[model samples]
Structure formats: structure tokens, C-alpha cells
Target: MSGQRDRGGYHRQRPPTPSSSAPNMSAADPSNVPDAASARSAVTDTSELVEARRAKLSAWRSQGIEPYGKRVEGLVGLAEARARFDAEVQAAYDEAVAAAKASSSSESVDDPRDRVRVAGRVMQHRDLGKLVFLSLRDHTGDLQATISKALVPADAFELAKRLDYGDIVVCEGPIGATRRGETCVWADRIELACKSLFPPPEKWHGLVDPEHRSRRRYLDLHVNPDSMRTFTARSRTISRIRRFMEDRGFLEVETPMMQPIAGGAAARPFTTHHNALDLELFMRVAPELYLKRLLVGGMPKVFEINRNFRNEGVDRSHNPEFTALEAYEAFGDSGTMMELTESLVHRLAVASAEDRRGEDRVRTGDEDGPILPFGDLDIDYRRPFDRITYEDLFERGAGFSCREIDRVRARAREIGIDEAKLDDWFVVNEVFEHDAEPCIDPARPTFVVDWPSAISPLTRAHADRPEIADRWDIFIGGMEVGPAYTELNDPDVQLERFEAQLRDGGDDEERTFRSLDRDFIDALRVGMPPAGGLGLGIDRLVMLLTDRASIRDVILFPLLRPASEAGVE
Candidate 1:
């Protein structure tokens, strides 16, 4: 189709046809449509239906009504308005009306059902001559508004009939059940709020294309209730976590995202230079070091729930930018952190069960309690999570004890790793990760404790087993949810660990961001109490609880490549 450029620079193809442009317009079957990669070409700026909607905007202006409405007052939520429908009141009014009709009386009883003013985007519209039936939707839910020609003014009826899909409108009326018993608003007045400029996705197959859904998330949230529900649950989950921490006497604090030294965890960092200061900065991979400094400053209990950035690959559980929960408790050990982690997670699981059950009592333990579904598995979150020593798990899964250096190295080499150049502990870890990790039952929440000190640079060494660190990593559904550690407080040992890490300069990329945080060492010298630290991946937890398979599904507006960058047509 030929096109003409609009004032905003978008081209108008042609005026949309009435037959082709009703609410819930039936488009070509999605099965017949091209795959998502090629489907990007099907939608463009210049389109007939788009131009038609723009014409409605012009027509609205000509009629002395602004298509983009001003602030409306006294508007109630659609859900709240629907709830105002009193069954007893409606029955009384209906009975009185029937009595008047049967007696042929001229008198009438005043309609007393609750009256409300509400606004929403028009999702469905059926114009049958003089009457209009519309389905309006707001964030709360959908409500039907019925406008009869005899009940409303001539101009208001005309406005209701002319309304299109996606248009925002305000309705004022009494809430009552219709003849069909569907709770609806019998409209006495209707006014335009905003006119939509583009048609919504077809109703039957709303926003089915994955690429399209990500690119146009606004549409995705509106058209797909599942996406809406997932995000809603995510918000509540974060809120619940904050409340849980606060009730336990944890002070929430914020730390610098751009740090001079990214001395948290050993992960690749995204680097940038500050133009004003002429100094380089790295996006923090973890909040570990800064939080430790707070501990030195004598903050007894502190926590931070915020975003962390890392130069990492994207997958079902990985995101370059993600939310995390880091908490530190002074005078507490790794055992303390383990208890805290278990209590927090179990409470959350119970809350998830309560949310799913509504008013019903949530069962616990085995099949009776709240068993939240994670993918194909129903994770049992009852108290006393399964626990096993790292060494024992490694031996069981690798068919040899982790202390057997020769066997561990041989097994690493058998798995095609260059074991001769790697350290004994590194080889053991490699084998453990490759074999032992998979042995944990995905259906149970398990804690793998007592890692080797060589691999746990920040954990305090066990009293009896100096070679092993006092640390534990929690796993659920084959994914590591979080890790807890009895933080090392000795300034000398901490400094020695830092120096050792520096000497063992990893590859070029690792060495670039790896540096000694002298300030943290100084803080340790100032004396930090024996403490326990915990870091939980908030995004991954949300994914599991929400039953979302991909991290991208739980995160609203997850990073995506631009169409041009993706090479999509």
C-alpha cells in the first residue's frame, strides 16, 4: 500500500475499514503466519488500520472532545466498582420493578445499588444499533458497562457506540447484575478519556510471538494475564522479603553500584570510566566486601536487596544484571546463617502456598503441606532441609574421595580437562561440579556444606578441619539459590588470602578486575565481630516460586537485542 508521512514522521498507509477494524479483529491464523524471526516484517509504521485509528483521533477533536483526556476525578477501580454490587439490594430493586410492571403502576422505586465512576481501556465493544455493551479493563480486572439509548443522552450513546478497542474511557453508573446475571454497570453517562492509535493484538492468540512479546511488553502484560500474574507475584515476593528482614532487626542499606575496586566475588565485571573524575570504575559483581566494611563499623545486622551487574552469559538462570539479597549478622557463624536461610525460604514457600490456596489452610511436609511446583517437580519446602558434606557428596558421585588427589586429577583428565596444570583442589571442584552436583535430588532443598578452603577464599576455616572452610551453598531444583559463610575476621589471614589471589593471577580477563581491597583489609584490622554472611539470588527465587522456566520470564523488560542487532526481518 502507498503511504503518506504523518506530522510525527510515521507513514500512514490508508484508512482502516470497519469490517477489518472491530474489537477483537480476526487476523490471519497465527499458525499460517511466518515464524517470529520473519514475523517482525509483517508489522510496520505504515498501515491502513493505524491510519484509521488516527482519523478517529481527528474526528474526536472535531467534536469538541479531546482524544487525550484531562484528569478525571472520583474514579474507582473496576474490581472495586464490581464488588459494590449488593445482591440483596439488587433483588429488592428487581422485585419492586416487577411489581410495578405487573400492577401497571406509573410510580417507580429509586435504584439504590451503589453508584461508581470508573475508567478503563475498552477491551470489547458490541454496538447493537442504539445500545452498546463494552468490556472495560484496568489493572485490577475486567468489568462490563452497558449503555442503553433510552438511559443515556443522545451524544453519550453516540460516543459509546463509536468507541474502538484500546480506547480509554470513563463510565458513571450504578453497579448491578444484568439480565444474564453477569455483574455489570448500567451506564447513565459515558465520556472519552483517550483514543487508541493502533489496533491491539487479535484476541484468540494474544501476543503469541516471543520476540514480539519481549519487544512490546506493554502489550504483552495487557494481553496475557499469565505474564501479569507472574510480575504481580514477583512484586509481592520482594515485599515479603523486605518485611521478613525488617522484622528480624536487619537494617537495610544501599552501597555504591560503581566501585573503584570490585572486591566482592570472583566474577567478570563491566568496566567504565568516569569522565569527570578521570577514574575507572567497575559495576560490582557482589556486595560482599562493602557489606563487610559495614560490619567493621559495628552494624550488628544489615541487609541490602538490590541490583548487581556482571559480565555474564544469558540463560534460564543467568542475567547480566540481576537482583540479589545480601545480609550479614554480627557474632553469628555459618550455622546461624544456615538457620536464617532455611527459615526465610520456608516462610516464603508457605506464603506461596497460602497465596495459591487463598482462604484454605496450607499443608506442610510431604504431600500434605505446601509443595510449590517448580517446572516438573513439586519442591517440598518443609523444615529441616536435606544436608550433606561436600566431601561426602564428591566421593559418592565421583566414585573417589575428594582427598584422593591422584584419582581426582585422573578423573578431571578423563573428563577432558587439563588437570596437570590445575591445582589439586581445583580438579576436585571440577569433578564435584560435573558429577556430585547432579546427584542432589532436584525435588528437595539441599545444603552442601564444608567446602575446601582453597576454593572458598572468604570463608573462615573449620576449627577441626583447617583445610575446609565453614561455608554452605543451598540448592533447589538443580540450581544454587544462595550461599552462606562464616566470614573470616582475622586481618592477617584475610590479607594473606588477598595476596595469594593476586599472586595466582588467573587469565588476562580475571587479572584485569582482580585487585586487593586495601580498605577492606584496613577495616578488618579495625576489628569486625565473628559474623555470618548470606547472598540469595532474588531473580532465580522468583523464577522458581512463579514456576517460570527462564529468568527472562520473571524479569520485566529483560535485556533483549534490538531487531537490527538480532538481524530479524
Candidate 2:
């Protein structure tokens, strides 16, 4: 890799001429350099473009150059390389080059620009006879690389001209700006990193279809900059959440994703069979029960952020498999968990606001707090989120008290709910979900508390109001973020609730999955302390924070039907 300084302050590699021994290095081979028309036709005729790339791949190998390169050190990101460009240094070099040219001197100008090595997928390529310009994209962002026929080796220059839109390549050059003021890497050396054989998406309209984006996330990440930013934010947010919990004296823990009985929440579970034990196991619908077991085993404050699988329908806010954050604090009630949830959510919202609008632009105070947009609504995550009792909300929305079972049933039937098949409390909940939940302002985070004890089997009933469980669910942007419950630690009461739940199973499908966790009851008998438990939907939280419309957008790979079944080509 011997080099000389170019007029533009770039360390130029000595150009090599093709010898008789290297027949594949022939720069005159038309198949080796894809023309503009062939590149543009890739979207319409993928087979031709793929065949062309295959030919180039073979040509590189025949020239004793591996298309898939080995590890090289000191590789800088595209964004960082672009940032390293010094306008003053470039201006000085340009002036010196102009002076030498005007004097008819053969001496080369001293090139002092910062040198860098960068690698990324080729997103855009333009061949202009002696100069080839390429836009390369990495996860950080995109930067342009300029290759001059006089600077780099003949083989490297030929490789640059033949590069296809998804092919990854490494470039070593001085960090400088093009004549048009576009920041770029003035490459004197280029090497193929990975040869992409498949044709890429249309240049102007890349990977726009939602189904395709979700199915092929790798392509989506490369083409869609917003998707990359969203996923990066999601990763950072999860890490911040873990740190927040740890700072609050909570220990992060892991729980089993498979359970003998899906006893956490009332959701259908995906079942699997173990070959050695010859027993059926169910994917955990929630980590609630297992987390509670930790409380029994003397882990005073513990939390888990992991996947939960439910055999359920998928929609804007629902995914069959999703991430969740579940935590429990010993001797704390629903109020304590509510405070924790509110604080954690508020902190995340403030951080998100700072990221969106610069830190100086974020406003403060009670009334003017950090506001985040979710679809048509602007949600405020200020402290002291609105609170309302479930009964009060039901009364406000249905125009009657939920205690009036007959009126509740009538409202349920009026709203197209099958009141005849549901229990009294269940009928109340149906009306509440359909009519009451929407009464809360979409722009404000609200907690609907004191749900009926019958509906909250694992929650402790309030001492004063035996029928009202000490449970609260937080809703933001018209979506239920999570729920907190004062846990039921009494073995006798828990057993009774479990039995009642089994007796009240509405369908055979529900009955098949619903079972008593006798071991949990036994753990309770071992003298577990009263605790507050909360479960937050991580995917939905990300959707709200990132302002994404659907859960599928935030999820890297959401479940979908096969291509044939989905009617996709």
C-alpha cells in the first residue's frame, strides 16, 4: 500500500496496470463496470442485475482478490468520518494546488488533511469517467466517497465502478469536502467487504411497504433512517429503564419464559412439549407469578425485562410476542408502585423530549411539561398523573353506577356485548372497557383504580371495601400502559380465587389453559410478605415514546403469515 500525495491533499495509492498474468483485471471488460442504465434497470429486471453482480464476483476472485474481505483495524463510522472533515485544511490544500498549477510546477502540494478508513453498504453510485462518486450508508448515517482513477490502483478503481447498491466496501482516504461542498472521503484505496448479489429496492422509493419492512428488518434498517433511529432509541430507553430501577434500589432479575401452568394473567399461552420429560409446557403469558415467587424467597425488590408470549390477536397495540417490565417491592401497595411507574415514565418522557427538541427547548413546570405526540394526541407525562376510580369512571361513561348489575347488563347489551354469557362483574368490565375507558383524556396519563375484586383474582381486596381490589391501571394516549396490584399473599384467599376462576371459565379453550398453580399457593403458605407488583408493556411504551403508529413498527420482527398466505410475491 505505497502512496504519494495528490494535489487535493489526498495520499494517492500507486495505480497498477493490468498484466498478461492477470487476465481478469482487464479494465476494458464492459461486464465488470455496470453502466447507469443497467443500474437503473435493476428495479425492473433483478435477474439481470444479479447475474451481472455474480460475474463481477467471479472476476474479483480470478484477480486474486477475495470479494469478502478480512478484518481491518481503525475503521471509522461514516458519520464520524464526515465529521472529521476540516474546511480550513481543505481550503489550504486547494489554494496550494491552484498556486502550483498556475506556476507550471511539477511538484506535488503537501497534503495534510485527516485520513480515515470507513466501510458501509453502497447506497448510491455515480461514474463520471475519471471520477466515481458513491454514497455509503452505515447504521450511524450516510457519507459520500470519491474515487479518482489517477489516485487508487486500477483494480480498486475498477471495483468502485462496478459496485452495486447493496454491496459493502471499505474506503481509506483523506476526510475532505467535494468541490460542491458535500462532505466526503476522498478515497485512494478501496476494497470489497461483502458482495451483495441480490438487487436492491428502487432508489427513489426504498422499502416503503410496511409488511416488507417488518419481514426484512435488515433491509429496512439500511433504507429507512427513521427505523434505525427508532430501534437505537428503543435500546437506549431499555438500558435507561434498567439503570433507573437499579438506582431506586431494585435488583434486575431473570424469570422463566416457560411455565408448568400459565397462571400469571388470563391469556392463552403457546404450548411446547419437552422430549426428555415427556411433558407439555406453556410459554409464559406474563412473569407476574414467577416474580412473586422471588418476593416469597426474600428478594425484597426485584424486576425483570423480558419477553412474554400470548396466543392472542395482533393489532396496533397488541403483539403475540412482546417485551415487558415487571417489578415487585416488598410491603409496598398499589400506591407505591403507581408512584414508581409515574416517576419512571416521566423521566423517560423528559429524556425523549430533550432528544426530540434540544435540551434548552424543553419547557418545565406543572402545566407546561414535556409533551410527546402519539398519532393525533399530544400526551403529557408530568408528575402526579390524573387518577380516577373504576366505579366512578364507569358511572360517568355509562350514566349509572356499576353496582346496579341490571343496568350494567343493560348497558353491556346495548353496546353489543353478550351480557347473558358473562358474570355480573365481567359485564361491568365489558361496559367499562367499551364506554368508560375512553372517558379519560387521551392527552393526559390517568390511573383507573379500585377495580372489582372478582376481576382481579391475584390482587388484594381493600380492607374497607371488600369488593374493590387495590389495583390500578395506567393509560396514556388511549392505551393501557400497565397495571399495578397490591398482591394477594394469603394462601386460602388465593386458592379460593383460583378455584372460582376455574369454575367461571367461559369456554373450553379458556378452561384448557386456565389451571391452578398449587405451588404458588404453597409458596404463599411459606409466609410471603405483602408486595406491590406492576407489569408494563415495553413495546407499547416504545410506540408511545417513539411516536410510532403500530406495535409492529417498533418490533424488529413481528409475526406474520407466510409469503404465500400473505399474498406477497
Candidate 3:
């Protein structure tokens, strides 16, 4: 990939054309780069933010103040800052400050300002003669800080006045309340924490541009407190999941992300070359096969919570890469995995409700799940999630069970499934999606079980019912969150499934890696214990738990195009 100049003056990797850059437009007029002329021309650009910060930085520097500050550790969180507030203490303190100013002869006097140290990005600042008010924000939350000239040293008070919003500042102050009862730290000592060279996003709307927010999430996180909370909740949710899995005795393990064959799922791989080894490697689409292999290797139980790369489209729900958790147990079957998935998701929902404030969880942002609002519907992740077989759901949705081939085909035609041309399974999936999928309560984390054997290549078929595979997909908020599979330990059966998949037009590239899982079979031939496996979409889970509508929101650095940035030659 070659680097191309983006609109943000950042280098974005583009198709390898040539190292040559787009001719420097700035060479014609360096002064135009940050001038009002350029700014008005592209007011949409974040450079407007940069320019604003530059002006503020200049003003502060002219006043002999550093726009960027020094190292100041031991910053207290907003929640902690709020804890220091005391109504009675603050009233007395305010009186003390008033008296100190009025009593010129008063030599020694008691001051009631709360003495505490905290550091944060300056979000809001107001200086009123002998007093200053500021809003300090950190990952935990935000609070107001007040500095009175009479309380802080003369130099410190001056520093407080010179402080610009977005600058990092550390202040030692007494915790008290403003007359309005807003919790505030009364500053006695102030120090520069760190200088922000760039201007912040719109203080009111913050970083509202989706593209910019994704590109410079660090800026978004600081500017938008809600963004920080979303990410923080995502982390805590993952942490809780790990604890849940571990408590259930699932041993976590790392697997080879680079594989000779990306055979586990029907998704494109991110291919890369190992120059030294001269071997092609693929970013795994799923850790399913490896985790299953671990079960075969006598690991008894194993799980991998990691990433899977799917070279696919970008949408509200899709990303090129995303996190997943895949687990396998030696003696469990699909039913076991089903139970585990349900309990896990239920626990997550309960925990999220507990962690969130207001009605976001209980009311739901979406109408699909429980009463807990999802996008618009309250997603109900409550226990005993709805369960319906593929046939049952299809029958209800298509007005005929999947077994009613003729009607299924007719419905498919009506739905543009082209049943007359495609494979039986393809047509089945088509109607299943448009029709059957809608039958499940999107608000309920429901599982549609027993997929058609053709689509579930790796899943085992019910002995009594070879037409239906022992598999299930769990859906919530109109998205498939994960799937569960009963183990197929018979090598001969496994080989048959693989061969049938190839015969179905999965060409050479796929066969090379999908080739009969001989080693897996060998393990099965060793009389391995039957097991159930589960693969979960961790990012999507985070999105649900954090109430982020798009998969991109929960993701830290979703891939994006670098905006064209102009610069001086």
C-alpha cells in the first residue's frame, strides 16, 4: 500500500500506485494553509479545530504561559472529585474567603477550602475577577473546579486564568460547592498538566462527524464523555465475560491466527505473505477449527476470546475485523452449548442493566429485544430465550414449513430468492432470512436451531433426522450474535461433510485448506469425548451491552479512508 495525503493532512494507505505524492498545493501558498481563506473554503474540516487551538495557544504563550503543561500525576477521577463536596463546609469556606478580603488587619485566619489534587482536560473555564470556575473531565466523569485569587497563590491564580479549555491542568483545591450547589474544587494550588496543541471539537456537539470520530477516536473520547463511557462499559463487559467463562471452568488458550486454510466459515480472508518463510498466511475468519482441535487433543475444554478477520463489506453491523469468543467442551453437545450461551447472555444483560443509569437498559434503544430499549425497542435478554426450529420458524414466516418444498420455492420466488436456479440450501436460507428470521422476537435473544444440513458443513446431523444439522444461531437486535454446534467426532462423517462441501462448488483454494480434516479425524478415532462448541461475536456483544447501534461504535479504530489533508511542501 502506498501512502496518500488525506483531507486531515494525515497519510492514508492507498493502492500501490507510486510513492510520488499529489503535487503540494500548499507550495503555492503556505500562508493559506491555516488562514481564514482555507478555513472558510472547507469549514467541515477538523483543521478548523486545529486552527482554533493554535490561536488559543498563541494567546497563552504571549502571556508567558505554556499551552502544553508538564507531568502532573495523581489526578483524581470526577466521581472522586464529586465525593469531596460538602454543603456546610463550602458555605463556611465561602464566608471565610469573604472575611479574609474584608478584614485587612486579619493576619492569621482559618480557611475552609477543600485541599485536594486532581488532573484533567480543561473542558470549560470561566474566570471572574477574584474567582475562576472550570469543568475538569476524565474517563470516570466530569466536575467543576473553582479557583479564587485569595485562595490560590498569585502565580497559581494567574495560571488558572491563562488555562485554555482542552489544556491538561492539575489543581490542588478544597472540595466545596458553588452557591448553585454545583460540586466544585476550590483551588489553592494550580499547575500545568499538559498542553493540548490541537483545538477540541465543537464543545456542544463534540466530534459529530462519523468519519472523523472513527478516524481520531482518541480525540472523540476526550471531547465526548459519552463515548468514553461506551468504551469503558465495553471493557468491563468483556472483563465480566472472561470471568464468567473462567468461573465455568473454560480454559482460555491462544490459537494460530494465521492458517493454511481459512476453512471454518464461509468468509473471505485477509491474506498476507511471510517473506522469510515464503508461505501465504490468512487472518483467521473463526477460531472454531483450532479450538475444536484442542478438544480433540485431550484439552478437555478450551476457549479463545480473540479476533477474526473477515474481508467483507462495511455496514452498520459489519467490519473487516472483529472480536469473537469460541469455546469447546469435550463432553458437551449442542444442547450444552445452547444452555451456556443463554446463561452467558442473560448474565450480561443483567449486569449491563445494573451498570447503566436511567432507562437505557431497561427501556432499550431498539424495540427488538426485551423491554430494555435497544435502538428503539427494549431488547429482552431475559432467561429462557425463545427457541424455534428452522422448520417451525420457516413455517410461521413463509406460511409453510421448510418441508413444504413447493410452497417454500414459491415463497422464495415471491421474495426474489430465485429458488428455480440456486441450491436447495441457498433458497432455504434466503426465505429463512427474509421471512423466517422475522418470526423470531428480535427483542428476545432467540436461538433458531437445527439448520439445514447443506449450509452447516461442519455441524453434525441428527442420527434420526439426517436432513437437519445439530446447530443453532442466536439472534438479538436483528443480528446473529453467535452459533452453537454439536461435535461430529466421526472421521468418516467428517470426511463426507468436507467432500460434500467441495462437490458443492467450493473450488481448489478452499479444498486445499478444507481437505479432509485427517488429524481431527485421527483424534476422533481415538474415542474422544463428544462436545458442544460455541462461537460468539464479542464486538457485537459489546455493542449490545454498551447500547451502541453500529458495530463501528464499540470498535476502537474502525478502518476508514484518510481525508485529504493539505500541507506545506
- lDDT values, one for every candidate: 0.85, 0.86, 0.77
Residue range 1-569, candidate 1, lDDT tens digits: 11212311221122234654333322333343343322333464344687788887888788887888889899999999999999999999999989999999999778988999999989889898977899998888899999999999887888898899999999999999888898889999889998988779887688888767777788888788788888998999999999999999999999999999987788889998999999999999999999999999989999999999989898889989999999999999899999998989888888877776642333444446667788788888877899999999998899889988998988898898888888888889999999899999888899999999999999999999899999999999889999999999999999999999888947877887788999999999999999999999999899877788889888888887744422211
Considering only N, C-alpha and C atoms within 3 Å, which residue pairs clash in candidate 2?
A: none
- Stretch of 10 with least lDDT, candidate 2: 1-10
- Model 2 deviation from the true structure expressed as Cα RMSD, one decimal place: 10.6
Backbone clash pairs for candidate 1 read 363-369, 363-370, 364-369
Kindly give the stretch of ten consecutive residues in candidate 1 with the minimal lDDT sum: 2-11
Overlapping backbone residue pairs in candidate 1 total 3
lDDT of model 2 at position 486: 97
Query: Once superposed on the true structure, which residue ranges of model 2 sit more than 4 Å away at CA?
Result: 1-46, 358-369, 565-569
lDDT of 3 by residue, 1-569 (tens): 01221332322212223553433335344543343333434544455556766776676678776656666666677788788777777777677767887887566657665567888789998878888898998888888888888777787787788677788888776777777888877777877767676666778878888778888898989888778888988898888889999999989899888987776787778888899999988888888777777776788888888989988799988989899989998889899999999888887877777666365446322333334566876777766889988888888888876776777788888876657777777787899899878778877788999998878878889999997899999999888999999878777888777777767655576555444446666766766678898999998988887778998899999977655443422
TM-score of each: 0.89, 0.88, 0.86
lDDT, candidate 2, 376-477, per-residue tens:
877877878899999999999989999999988888888899889777888899999988998999888899999999889899999999999999999999
User: Would you give me the overall lDDT of model 3?
Assistant: 0.77
Model 2: lDDT of residue 531 = 93
